[model samples]
Target: MLDAVVVGAGISGIYQLYRLRQAGLSVQLCEAGDGVGGTWFWNRYPGARFDSESYTYGYFFSRELLDEWSWSEEFAGQPETERYLNHVVDRFDLRRDIRLGARVSAAVYDDAAAAWTVTVENGERLRARFLVTAVGPLSEPYVPAIPGLAGFAGVWHHTARWPREPVDLRGKRVAVIGTGSSGVQVIPHIAAEAAELVVFQRTANWCTPINNRPITPERMREIRRTARTIHRTCQETPGGFVHRPLSVSALEVGEEERRERFQRLYDAPGLTMVLANYRDITTDRAANAAVTDFLRGKIRERVKDPEVAERLIPTDHTFGMKRPPLEDGFYEVFAQEHVSLVSLAEEPILRFTPAGIQTAARHYEIDVAVLATGFDAVTGAIRRIDIRGRDGVRLDRHWEAGPRTHLGLQSAGFPNLFFVGGPQSTTGNIPRATEIQVDWVMDCLRHMADHGHRYVETTPAAEEAWLAHVESTVRGTVLEDATSWAFGSNVPGKPRVYQLYAGGIPQYRARCAEAVEAGYTGFVFG
Candidate 1:
């Protein structure tokens, strides 16, 4: 039996393995895909890139690794991101312990033995003292139950499960669905090549232009020189990134000054315009409208047709509430002669014909349909495995109402099991969040070892309090107003409750620190 078994060979799992080995534990990782890079590995869709700057989006544990590997772009694309992860795996020599193309089917705790027996799809059973699920929050791809989808003779693909070889869209008619981050990014690229591109948007999304540019060698040198400072900045911020600090609320600024500030952020790169520029963009309605109006104006200005522009404007939710997507020429892409925008809200898709999709309004013939529909988010991947805890209590039944996680790290009934960057945690910059959770798990394990304890799990009472705390943190925020994936609202029949801890990363870190100082107050060890 191994000391620990980790599920999912993404960045989180990679770090978990690295740290576990450092602690002199025997650990093994199983991945569903054929390689490392978890989400990046599966999501090879065109135009997929990090919203956060490349420098701020990587692992923070190794300075040597940081100094050695270099990024080619400020906002790295999927290919580059995959390359970086592959580099990390090679640099750390982490492949020997990782079993690729092995998807975990079930993990059941042996209460008497105080261990877990994990079963994979390949009929392999592995026993471990502790099971750590590093399976990504956005790992599960969601395909909507559209009627007659199987009837479509044309090729269809989900963004999450895009083929390794590029799909040839040039001179081909393509239909794209969903206007979330991935859809927004993919549309522009598709519009560039597709002979006729039709976009099916269920809801319009808030999008800001990305100031994407190449990272020069000189810039790399400067980053290396002040690498410590950059890493420190990441730690100090709420999100694990360095960007514009909005000291005053949006209402505090004068009209001209507000426009100027918005303009400056709009001109700048990454998430500055929506997430970092205004303090009250997500909190206060009036402030959010101010930013919303500016973004809507930008969209209207870019797209030539007023009706099309209005169709693209999102009025249902507050700005920055639904995860705002950063884009390049996304708004402008609609103006292309070959492009057409199909509003699903206006005309719901009835079914798919043998040749194409048939909406209530009309049917459009297309060679390929790409479903950029988002994932099942945090809880989906975990529930995919038949995880049974105390007395064989199913994880699905436990989370049937919604996910209940103490600090998003452990469930109440599951002993000797842990989750890294799981649901109900402050899930911002993923690598940073992963580092925090992995470090905490290591600390908890060490504490258990030092105390001669064998079992650890969150108490029901503690789990309840944490869930309450999560609700309180996100109660009045814009995140609560939307039917977005943030609230598990994207997938039909999924619970409408807020599943993510909306509290800032810094605050979450402080709370985690307090728990450690107070003997991991939310958890119980035996």
Candidate 2:
């Protein structure tokens, strides 16, 4: 029996395995895929890239590793990112500890032994004192419930699960569905190759320029100088990206300055243009309008057809509520003669025909279809695993309405079972959140080991209190109104509770700290 077993070999899983190994713990990492790089390994579509940019969307644990790797682009594609992760595995010698092509089927807490017996699909059973689920937020792909999605005779693909080999869309009529981040990034590439590309937009999405360019050698060296400081500062930021150098808040800049910078910023691309309004865009309606309108005007200018441009511009939700998209010429691609936008709200998908898709308006024939529908997110991966706690109660049955856990890590009934990015996790608690979380779990494990403890679980009170706090946080912000995967609003039949903590990332850090300082208060340490 190993000391610990980690599920999923993504970025988080890789780091988790390394940390435990460095602590001289007996641990093994299991992945269902053939290799490492969880998301990067599967999503190999044309324009699939990271929104957080190249250098810092990686492990910051080792200075040598940080300094050694060189990024090929400002925002890395799926292939390049995969290579980097594989290199991390090779350089750190993480292969021996990893069991690839092995999917954990079920995990049950055996009260008699006080250990989790994990069963793999191939009938391999392994027991460990701790079972950590490092399954990512976007692990499972979601396909829409359109009447006849499977009936379409030709090729159909989800962006999340795109084919590993090259696809030929040239001279083929293609229909692309969904307008989220991946949809926005991929449409242009699809349009370029297809004879005619019809984009099905259920909701018009807000888009900012990616402004991606090759990271110059000179700039790379300069970043290397302050790499440690930058890495530390990013932990402090909300979304894990390096914030702009402007110290003053957007409100501090003048109106004229704001207008000029907003225009300049809008053109500059990446995330810099997201805040041209020079004020708080989240709560303040006017500030949010300023940013949204600027992007709308940009779309109008680039798209050739006025009707298509109007269809492309989103009017309903707040900017940050849904995951924001970034691209250089996504809007411009619509100007192409072969490209057209189909408003799904205007013309709902009636069904899929043998040769084409039948929207309410008309039937458009296509050779290939791209279902850019996003993942079930946050809850999907954990739900996929069959986890039974002390009473042989399933995690899914307990979470039928919604998911609930203390600190999104430990559940009340599940003793000795752990989750890395679990429910009730304060995701908004920026830079220090993940650092604080991993530390807390490790501390709990170490404490249990030293004291001859068997299994430590959260009290029902702790789970309920933390769950209420998470709900309150989500309802307090614009996030509650966000009808995206973040709130489980996109997928039907799933509970409508908030999956991530909307309170500021820094605030979350303090709460976790307080819990630890109070000797893991509310946790039942046996």
Candidate 3:
């Protein structure tokens, strides 16, 4: 049996495999995709780019790797991001151990042998002492159950599963559904090409400007010089970004000063508008409302039509409640003559007809359709795989109410199984968060090896305590009130539970450190 088997060759999986192999352990990685890069590889839609600064989103473990790769833009596009991941894989020679096109169908734990037998879709099975699921939280694409999709004559594609080949939308009548992050990004590019473009939005989201620009040679040099400092800032901040919120609350500031600060952030690059905003904007009702009003005003100013502008503005939730996408001229796209906005809430979609979508009010004729509907999120990817632990307990059934785990790492009754970037994990700057998780898992594995333990799992009491801590941490935050994918609200019938650990990165790290100090408390190894 191998020492470990890691599923999904994404950022987390790649790093995990590298760390495990470096420790002289027999480790193998399995990727479902034909190629590596996981999220970047599959999400090849137009205008897909980094919201986080390119530097902060990449691996910080190697100074050599950081010095070699130079990003072209402050926020690199999908192509560049995919290439960067491929570069990392090649640089580390990680491909030989990674089996491409090997989708994991089931992982069953053998209590007697103290090993996990992982079955791939291709009838291949691998037994390992430990199993690490690096399958990303957002890996499973979620397409809404709209009737007559199969009967429609026009071609339809989910944004997550966009074809590798370039899609020709030139002069074609197109309909784009859902206005989440991907929708906002791809809609602008589609509008520029399609003869008639219709955007179907169920709920309007808070979007700020990306303001992406090419990185000059001078800036690249400066970035390389301050690479350590940049990574340090990400480590120190709450959201794992270089952007830090102000110390004072928005309620503490004057209206004039607050509006001015909001405007500056509006014009600034990346997610600074939200991540670097007032301290209380995400917590205090009045502070969140003030920032929300400012953003609504900006949206109104950009869109020429008053009705369309009003449709674009979100009314239900606060500004930072849902994860906001950084956009480039997104609101301005509606100003174009050929581009139209269809509010799904006002006129719900009846079904997909032969020509296009038929709503309650009217039918939209289109040649092509694009679904930007998001993912099942945190627990979806792992739950899809048939995972059986002790006593043939099903993972999906165990998490039917919601995910139960200790620090999002391991669940009770699931021996030798670990999760990185899974449910109850950190929220922002995914790569940075996953890096921290991977390091901790490696440490835990080392601990097991040194102690000559073959099986390990979290205690039921520990898992319950961690779940309680997660709930308590997000109890009063704005996130608890919002009905978004962050809380698993987008998927119908899915448990509406807070999916991520709302605690800051520093606190999470400290908690892990405490576990180590207490001899890996709440975990049993035999």
Candidate 4:
């Protein structure tokens, strides 16, 4: 038996375990993977890296950890990010309690036991007073329904489940499916190696330049000096990433002024336009069109081939509604002699032949197919496991409509069960949200201990009300215009409701504070 069992070894899970241990709790972190890094640990495609700036996309809890670890690029790649996470684990000596390669198959709470009985796939059983799920929002790999994908004779891998051994695509044809963030980032790198690369893209997202460069000693120093300010700025800002701090909405600005602002921010690169577009894009369809049109034009101008460029434009959805993708020289890769953009819309992939994939338009032969198809997002991780609470109510059935929890942490039926960076929390950049949420969970659990509460859970009524609030919050926003993982629209038959609180990080932090002030509102203690 342990005080807490965290069901992930990702960054959030690492933070949760470290904080809980610091709070005098005995914690055991079980991970399905053999090692740490969670999503980073797994996603090892060519050129997979963090799009968000590295200096900010990291843990803020330990100033020492931040200062001690160094990044290879302005935005750290997957390998370096994983290395940093491992470094933190070693620095804190946090590996003693973490059991790797042990996938938890079931976690059930017996009312009489007042503890969670966790059963692993290997028949190992453990009990814990508190259950924390650090399964990331983007943890689950989602391969689209491409026919005969299983029978492909050559190499096939998802970015999420990259092979440990090196893959050789030197003179072989390579096809990459899904041009989302992963595809955008990896395509150029893959195209450089593949004899000929075909990118089968369904939708074209607004791709911004990474503007990624090596982090200088001078730059690191400046960021370290202003770490507090950056954290504050991110908390106050709409997106988790630190961008323009805006007090006024853009709708209030005159057309000329707004266009000028848009021009300036658009040139600025990566998420600048998001805050600039914050004014009326969600409310004013014209405003949304103006920005989307600008992006479409930008994408069109980048590709060498006009026909290919036209196919890349996202006609249906507004910008930023779908998780905004940021990349460098993505469209330019199509100009390369080795690269070809396959329009999945016009010529849908019919099936995969034994040799390679085939579309209605052509029978292209390839040695490898890289599935950049993103995760099932928010709910997939939790759904992968059997979680039962209160009278053996299965979590799968409970979340049939969508995930429901108070403050994205504790579920109503499962007393002592906590989730870090889960549904109903900020889904932008996670490191920032992880810091705030971890702090709150730690403080809440401490409060429970101090008050001599043996058990605590969200009230059923409170969970329903909170779920409704999450759904309603995005109703008026531009997110409703299309299917996004944030709204659980990307995955087929998944609930249409959003998984994040869309109310900005500051408001989320404030509500959490208020909940603590109000004795953990929407929750009950015994």
Candidate 5:
């Protein structure tokens, strides 16, 4: 039996495999896709790019890798990110251990042996002492329950499952449903090409400019020169990525100063500036209102039609609560003569016709349709696997109410089964967070080895405490009030729990450190 069987060969899985090997453990990673780069491999949608800056978006374990690999842009697009992952795999010689196109159907723990039997699609079974699920939180694409979707004569695709070939949108009438991050990113690109573009918005989202640009050789030299300082800054910041954190509350600033700051942030590249600049923007409703109003004004200025601008402006949730999209000309897309906006909130989608979608108002004919709807998130990917633990307890049945894990790493019944980037874990600067998680999991595994422990699992009490702590972290905050995929609000019938840990990276890192210092507190080893 292998020491561990890791599900999903994404960034998390890749790092986990490396770390496991370093610890002298026999490990293998199974990826469903024909290639590596899990999310980047699948999501080839137009305008798809990383929200995090390119420099910090990669693995931090190897300084050699850091020095060798260079990013082309400030924000790497899907292709570039995928290429980077491929490079990492090639550099590490990880392909030999990874079984691509091997989709794990189920994982069941055998109490007697203290090992997991992982069954793949072709009825092949692999035994492992431990099961590490690096299956991403946002891996599962959520298709909305639209009636008569299959009957559509025209071609349609979800942004997550876009075709490998370039979609010919040139002069074709297109309709994009849902205006989340993917929608926000994609709408601008297609708007330029489509003969007529119709965007259906359920809830208008807050958008910031993605001032993406090429990274110069000089920039890379500067980064390499100050790599230590940059790494330190990344760790110190609340969110994982290095940014200018808010030292002062928004309420403290004067109207003119605040407006100017907001405008400057608006002009700046990336999604975090406005939200991360002011501490009170996410806390105080009035402070959030000020930022929202400024953004709304900017939208009004960008879009020519006042009505269309107003329709695009979001007032439902406070800023930073929902997924903040970074895009250039996303708001301005409504101003294009060929593009039209249809607010689903104003008039709900009635049904889908063969030609196109039909709303309460009218039927809009389109040659192609794009579903930019997001994922079930956090628990979806993990739950999809038929994971039966001790006493035949299924992970899905256990987490039926919502996902509950001790430190978002290990569940109670699932001994020797671990999760990275799972529910209740911090997703701030995903790669940074993933590295931390992988390190933590590796440490725990090494501890098990040193102690002669065959089985390891978190106590039920610990899981409860962690779940409660996670809920408490978001309680009374603007994040708690917002209904987005981050909180499992996008999928119908999914429990509306705060899946991600709201606690900043620094605090989370410290907490994990403290737990390790206390001999891996709350975990039972046998």
Candidate 6:
């Protein structure tokens, strides 16, 4: 039996495998796809790019990797991102231990042996002393159960599961559903090529300009010089980003000054508008409203039609309550005559017609339909696998009310099973957050080995306390009440619970360190 089996070849899994192997453990990485790069590998949809700065989003574990690879764009697109991950794999010679196309069907823990037997879809079973699931939060795609979807004559594809091969949208009338991050990114690109484009927005999201630009040689040199600073800043910040919110509240400034501050943030690149704005934009209702109104006004200015502009503006949630999309020419696309917006709130999608989509108002005849419907998120990927722990208790059933874990790492009764970048973990700048988690997991495993521990599982009391802490951290924040994917609201029948640690990187890191310092206080080892 191998020391550990990591389920995913994504950012988290790749790093976890490398760390485990470096520690002299026999580890294997299993990827569902035919290749590496997990999310980047699958999300090959039009206009797929980083909302985070390319440099900040990448791996910072190796100084050599940082110095050698320079991002072409401020926010690198899918192809480049995929290539970067492939480069990492090849550079580190990680391909030998990775099993491609090995989708994990089930993972069952043997109580007597204190080991896990992971079964792949191909009927191969790999037994390992420990199991680490790095199956990303957004890995499992969520497609709405619209009637007559299978009978639709035209081609349809979910944005998350976009084909690796080229999908020709040129000259064809297309309908894009859902106005989440993926929808916001793909719509503009589709409008540029498709003969006619119809965007069906369920709840219009708060979006800001990405302002992506090429990284010049001079900028690359500067980035390399300050790589250490950049990484340090990322670790120090709340969201694990180089961007940090100002200390002063938005209410402290005058109306004109607030508008000017919002404008500067609006024109800025990536998530600066949200992450680097005033401190209370996400917490205080009045402060959030000030920023929200500023954003709404910007949307109105971009779209020429007043009615269309209002339709695109969100009414339900504040600016940062739901995760906003960083877009390029997204609002401007609605100004184009051939492109149209269908407010699903006004006329909800009834069903799928043979030609295209049929809403409550009319039938949209289109050659293609793209479901930018988004993912089940957080727990979906882990829950997809039939994971059984002590006494054959199912992981899905255990988490039916929502995910329960200590530090989003280990659940009670699931000894030797850990999660990286999954539910109840850090929320922002994912790679950085996952890096922190993977390092902590590595440290935990090392502690286990040093202590001659064969099995490690979190105590029920610790899991309960952690869950309570998570709820308390987000209790009064805008995110706590928002009905978004952050709380599994997008998926029907999924329990609506706060699924991520919103207390920032430093706080989460300190808590993890405390657990370790307390001799892994919450965990029981055998």
lDDT of each: 0.88, 0.80, 0.92, 0.82, 0.87, 0.92
lDDT of 3 at 283: 88
Error of 3 at 421 (Å): 0.7
lDDT of 6 by residue, 294-347 (tens): 898888998899999999998888889877898989999988889999999899
Off by over 4 Å in 4: 245-260, 276-278
Instruction: Give the range of the ten consecutive residues with the poorest summed lDDT in model 3.
Output: 425-434
Every candidate's CA RMSD: 1.1, 2.2, 0.8, 1.8, 1.2, 0.8
On TM-score, who's better, 5 or 6? Answer: 6
Which lDDT tens digits does candidate 5 get at residues 1-526?
9999999988889999888887778888999888998889889998999998888778777889989988899999999999999999999888889999999999999999999999999889999999999888888999998998889999999998898999999989999998889999999999989999999999988888888889999999888777777777788777777786587988998999988888788777786665357877877788888988887777888889989988888878767787588877888788789989989888889878899898989889988999999898989888989999999999999999998888888999999998888888856777777778889888888888788999999999999999998888888778889898877898999888899988877877887898889988898899
TM per prediction: 0.98, 0.95, 0.99, 0.96, 0.98, 0.99
Instruction: Report the Cα lDDT for residue 464, model 6.
Output: 96
Pairs with backbone N, CA or C atoms under 3 Å apart (clashes), candidate 3: none
Better of 4 and 6 by lDDT: 6
Candidate 4 local accuracy as lDDT? 0.82
Q: Give the TM-score of candidate 5.
A: 0.98
Error of 2 at 432 (Å): 7.2
* Model 6 ranges off by over 4 Å: none
lDDT digits (tens) for residues 1-526 of candidate 3: 8989999988889899889888888988999999988899889999999999898898988889988999999999999999999999999888889999999999999999999999999999999999999999888999999999999998899999999999999999999999999999999999989999999999999999999999988898999999999998998888899999999999998999999999999889999988899998988888988999999898989999999999999877779898898899899999899999999889999999999999999999999999999999999999999999999999999999999999889999999999998999867888888888899998888888888998889999998999999998787888879999988999999989999988978788888889989998988999
Residue-level lDDT of model 1, residues 376-465, one tens digit each, is 998899998999999999999999999998888888899989998689884667777778889999999999999999999998888899
List of clashing residue pairs for candidate 5: none
Q: Name the Cα RMSD for model 5.
A: 1.2
Worst 10 residues of 6 by lDDT: 472-481
The positional error of residue 499 in candidate 2, measured at the CA in angstroms, is 0.6
